[model samples]
Target chain A: MLLALDVMGGDNAPAETCRGALMACDRFPDLEVALVGTGSRVAPLIAEASSSVAKRLHVVNAEEVITMDELPSVAIRNKRKSSLRIAMEMVRSGEAQGCISAGNTGAIVAGGVLVVGRIPGIDRPGLGVPLPAIDRLRMLIDVGATVRSKPLNLVQFALMGGLYMRHVLNVADPKVALLANGEEEIKGDDVIAQARDVLRKGPFTFIGYVEGKDIPVGPADVVVCDGFTGNILLKVMEGLGEAVYALLREEMGQRILPKVGMVFMLPMLKELWTRFDYEQYGGTPLLGVRGAVIKAHGRSKAPAIASALGVARDFVLKRGVELISREITQGGM
Target chain B: MLLALDVMGGDNAPAETCRGALMACDRFPDLEVALVGTGSRVAPLIAEASSSVAKRLHVVNAEEVITMDELPSVAIRNKRKSSLRIAMEMVRSGEAQGCISAGNTGAIVAGGVLVVGRIPGIDRPGLGVPLPAIDRLRMLIDVGATVRSKPLNLVQFALMGGLYMRHVLNVADPKVALLANGEEEIKGDDVIAQARDVLRKGPFTFIGYVEGKDIPVGPADVVVCDGFTGNILLKVMEGLGEAVYALLREEMGQRILPKVGMVFMLPMLKELWTRFDYEQYGGTPLLGVRGAVIKAHGRSKAPAIASALGVARDFVLKRGVELISREITQGGM
Candidate 1:
């Protein structure tokens, strides 16, 4: 499969993106990676890879890079040769099966929608990220994508999240639920109440309304909500996880006794901490688009970028975009 | 000051309630404690407390106790002589300075609204609970009270939450913020966007739209949002906190080495854990009510009920209701 990688993406980019490409080439020798960015800037990092792995990598020379501060529309419009835009174009023009980026999210999203476009029946595309729950991780969608949404938008999110879990995570017939204040159908606002009705009547094992606490309990497979609530929940969870780890570290470092305890429990703590870490999960996928567009965090390192590339490859191999489009069009009307 | 205490409230119920009342009586000698419940079932617990430091405790005759499973309205309607109703009536008739219950939250809210009524000029009343943040606790209001709210309701929540911080927590001109998905003015839905405009022009020390991560930093004194988002955020925080604590406890209990270390740091760990304990802060107050009505946790113990009563006393003494009513009427127009 031919996958386009935006080398001028993320905080650690060109280096991290280059390393990830090389790593992907090593793991999947049959896979072809087209590194999209200024070839000179990306060459040093790409050269660090083994000759055999480097042989599988191709350079698509794009002169411009989208900065984090630039407005998404302006960046996408002005920098036609930007790595993100170029990579997106590769997928759109059938030069590559999928595209992956760890750059400014707004810019990547804009590029994906403008270049790849949305599926036929989908109203708005959504960003889905895996959250660490008790026993397993749950998928939370519309995380900062589609700022304003209707009941139909939420319905599409549930369908997409369900399909993603089945194809990517290999969870069959995932339990889909609407995120609300209460678990009752009668609860929540007009928007949520209407969404619940529509979702309940639709396909994919509808589980009705799931409360916020249920998100971490692994009770439901696909937890759906508007972008506003979903994004806030995602960020809050991220902040809380970081804060707890920091607090624990500071407290453990204070005294010799606690330090000893930390040393003894370091392995177990690390394993448990891994559950809340998002880096291990790679990046969020912008679902409901006609083509695969994986969005990694802007500060992602080599491992994260490589993971994102792997995710994009999986989507391409499994024909995820086609299946999601079919599901939406079939289930929606 | 006479305070009515529901002896048969919370998961621990009569035992914890009776003990909390006795503790309050001992702490505040002039404060009169009226234990409201069926004298037959409550006599044993009250007698037990009387043997302690609560010889002067008063027991009001009440036959029925609302169960968690019962519907709020049905429980209120059927159990006319229930402990919850009697306790609320005590405050409404001025026989008691305040009412405290660690019972069914919906029933408590229903009883508060039905009995005490909304304070003048208040559009809708809300519940404010202090959440454990990174450094300090922040107050989150409208947690499941009014799920479908307007722009004015959000503005009112800001006013109520601000007054709560100023009077209850003693923070002057507490920075108030409208919780949204982003910091931008154009970020949220129409209701929130309109609320932002209203708050900017109102009496609050209005800090613009705050993201979810901002809650933990305690950047704003008051964090306001609609009940749906507020409730979801509150529950998510609770679940996350519990998960972290459980993980820490498991790690601490792993082996003999960590167990030995745990012994040395037990005291310090206890102090740190207590700092984030919600029970220490007691119940959530139903703000914008004519009289103070505190809703304690269903699993509240003697100490939690006592703390809640103390909160109620402070609310009454500070004349928070009158001040909030005045602010709403003046600022709203």
Candidate 2:
């Protein structure tokens, strides 16, 4: 499968992105990548690769680059020759099976909708992030793809999220839940309540409402909500993880016994971190779009970018976009 | 200070509730408590207290008990003699300076509004929870008190929450932040955007928008949002904490060296738990009510109950309700 990678968007930019692309090529034998970036920067990295690896990796020159702070609409409109836009265009024109970018989330989401376009029956494309739950991965949809979502939008998110979990994550009859403050039928606001009504009778396996804690606890396979709530939930978890690490380090400093103990605890701590590693999962997929589009985390380095490329490859190979569109059309909820 | 304790509600019930009242009376020299519950169950627990504690603790018979599963509106209207309602009535009648309950949150919120009543000029009462921040305590308001809130309600939450931080928590000119999906001025939904406009012009130290991570990371003293979002954020944190604990325990079991290390690391881990302990802070105050009403966690034990009682005592002593009313009337944003 062929994939387009934006090599000059994220914090670590060309170097990490190029290195990640090479690493992904080594991992996926059949995978071919088009490194979309400036010729001067990307050519040397492509030239340095081993003969077999170099054969799979191609440099597609694009002079301009989209900065992180640029407005999504303005950047997409003005920077036509930008690597992000060029990579997206490759997917739109069917030059590549999928596209991966560690760029501005807003720009990626905008490009997913404006350039690649949404699926036929989908109202708004939702971004689905796979969070590592207790036993398996749980998909949280609309994590900042579309805010100010209506009841219909939430229903769409539920359907799309459920499909992603089932097809991409290989969960049979994925249990879908609407994210709310409480698990009761009468718990959430008007929007959530209305969505719950439709979901109870909708196509997917609706397991009812779930609270925030359910994300980490792994009650449901697909947790659906509006972009605003989902985004907040995602960020809070990230922030809490950082805070816990800081607090633990501070506590470790106060006692000499624990400091000595820390030497033996290093392996266990490494295993714990690996169990909850976001880098290993790669990128969050912008679901409901016509083409396979994966938005990697902005701060992602080589390992994370490579993992994201793997995700994009899996998405394309699994035919996620087609399945979601067909399901939404047939379900007709 | 005279306070009413609802001993009939919560998981631990009369035993923990009565035990907590006695503990609070001992801690606060000027404090007196009226234990509200069934005489049969509550009387025995109170009798076990020391002579001085017994002298200060009074039994107020409340024959009915509100179950956690009951509808808020139905429970408040029908179970008028319920311990939750009786405690609220005590505040309403000026018989107690404030009220504390480790009961159904919906019932507590309903009772605070229906029985204790909303403060004059207050659109809706919000639940303000004191979270342990990096440096000091940060108050998160509207955890579940008022859902389907308007922009006006958020503005009111800011004012009341700010007053709460300044008076009860004792932070001078407390910085207030509106919780949203992003920190950008143009980030949140219509209601938040409108609230942002009012907050920038209205009284208080409006610190623009804050994402979910700010709760643990400590950027603002008072974080205001609709009850729906706030409740989810709060529950997510609780869920995440539990998940982390479980994950770490699992990781520890996998290695023998780490198991030995865990013995010495217990103290550091204990300190970390204490630092993030919600029970030590006691109950969440129901702000914008006519009188002080603190809602303890439903699963609270004796120590948590005692902490909540301490919070209620502080709220009454600090004249939180009166100050909030006065500020809302004068500010009139």
Candidate 3:
């Protein structure tokens, strides 16, 4: 199966993207990647790949590029020939089974909705990211896909997220929940209450409202919320993780005994970090869209990009979009 | 100055609360603490203190106790003679300069508003907790005080938080910011945007918008948000810290090398924990109330309760409530 990769996306653009494509091709013999970018930047990188890997890599040269700072809708409308838009178009036209882009998140979400379109019966698409919890991976939905979500949209997120967790991630009898400030029945605002009301009768076991603390504790397999809350929570967790690691390193370096202890603890610390790192988790899937669309992190390196490609390949193979579409249609929102 | 302590509150009550009160009395030679609880439960604990401490510690008999699981408003109204309510009453009647409670947060907010009352010109009271950031402490407000806040209420939170940080925390010019999904001007929902517009024309230097990640980085001295968002953010940070510490301990115990390294790293790690620990920072102040009402953590032990008492003392000494009242009335909220 052919997958499209936006080579002009992310901080480590064409070089890391190219390296990732080759790595993915090497890992999956059945997979082929179409690198989307300007010919000048994309052609030379493909040449560096071995003959066997190079054959599976196809370069789709698009002259325009979208920077990280541009407005999503405006940039998508103006830069139709941009690598991000072209890669999205590949998924739209069925040329690629799935598309992965590490470009601006806003632009990618806009492009995914406007270009790839929404799934039938889905009001708004939700972005789902797998958070590495203590016991299991929990899928948090609408992590900045649609900033302002209605109750119906949140309900759709639960349905779509629940399906993704069950089908793609292979979780048996996935427990879905709404993320709120409190766990009580009357915890969140009107939107959350309404969503919880609908989800109670809908497909799967609705675990009611789970607070932010419950995310790491792995209370629910699929946690749904509006894009605004999810985005803030995601970033806060990331920032805290970075701060903790940095503080530990600084503290260990300043003290004599701890500095000596750091030598023996380095291997264990590295392993623990790898277990918690978002890069190892690959991309966040933009669910409820017409086609499979994966958004790799903007700071993703070669390894992360390769991991995202693997995710895209799995998402396509698992028929995530098809499962979600069926579930939403049958669930009667 | 006299301060009232809710002896029947928190996971470690009576014993911890009495110990903390004695410790506070010993530290502040001029300070007296009224231990409010059942005479049977509190009298013995206070008698265990030294002669000087016992003389300074007064026993106020309270027949009832507010459990953590009870509804805030319902419990506050019904449990009139409860330890929590009696402590709040001491502040209300001017019997004590301030009150410290490590009880149910909802009950505290309800009781503070019901008994101690709101300051004039203040629509809602906000709970401000000092987050230990890398460079300095950033105070986050409206953390589960009034869960659903209007635009005007958010604006009020900013003003109160700013004044508290400037006057009580001693920041020369406090930078106030609204916590939102994004840093962009048009980021959050209508309430946040409206609040930002009003803050722009207000007295303090409005920093516009800061995301959740900015809390740990200390971009703004005071971060204001609706209680729902603030509460989740605070709890999530606490939960993450606990999870990290637990994981590290478990990992260290499993590995022989890391186990030996942990022995050497124990002191440094303990010091680091103390620095980041919320217990060390003391209680969260219920701002915009008529009197100083400090809410300690529900799981607070003796040391945390002692630290909370210190915070209560400082809040009363700095005239936190009067300053907030003057600012709100003059600032035209």
Best candidate (score: DockQ): 2
**Candidate lDDT (C-alpha), each:** 0.83, 0.87, 0.87
- Output the lDDT of residue A182, model 3: 81
What TM-score does chain A reach in every model?
0.96, 0.96, 0.97
**TM per prediction:** 0.94, 0.98, 0.97
**How displaced is residue A11 in candidate 3, in Å?**
1.1
Count backbone overlaps in model 1.
Answer: 1
Which rank order by TM-score, best down to worst? 2, 3, 1
Candidate 3 lDDT tens digits, B1-333: 999999999999989988888888888888899999988887878777888888888899999999988988999999999999999999999999899999989999999889999998889889999888766889999889988899989999999888878877799899999988888876799989999999999688999999878888857999998898888888788878778778888887788998777788889888776767777877899988888899988888888888889988888888888887788778777
Query: How would you encode candidate 2's per-residue C-alpha lDDT over A261-332 as one tens digit per residue?
Result: 888888888877786798999799998887889999888999999999999988888999888878887887
What would the per-residue lDDT of candidate 1 be over residues B137-156, giving only the tens digit for each residue?
78988887777679988889
Q: Worst 10-residue stretch by lDDT in candidate 2 chain A?
A: A246-255
DockQ value for model 1: 0.57
DockQ of each: 0.57, 0.76, 0.68
True contacts kept of each: 0.56, 0.77, 0.58
lDDT of 3 by residue, A1-333 (tens): 999999999999989988889889988899999999987888887787888898999889898999987888899989999999999999999999889998889888898889998888888888999998766788999899888789999999898888888888898799999888788776788988998889899588888998878888857999888898788889899887777778888876678999778777889988887887777887899988878799998888888899999898888899888888778767766
Expressed between 0 and 1, the share of native interface contacts present in candidate 3 is: 0.58
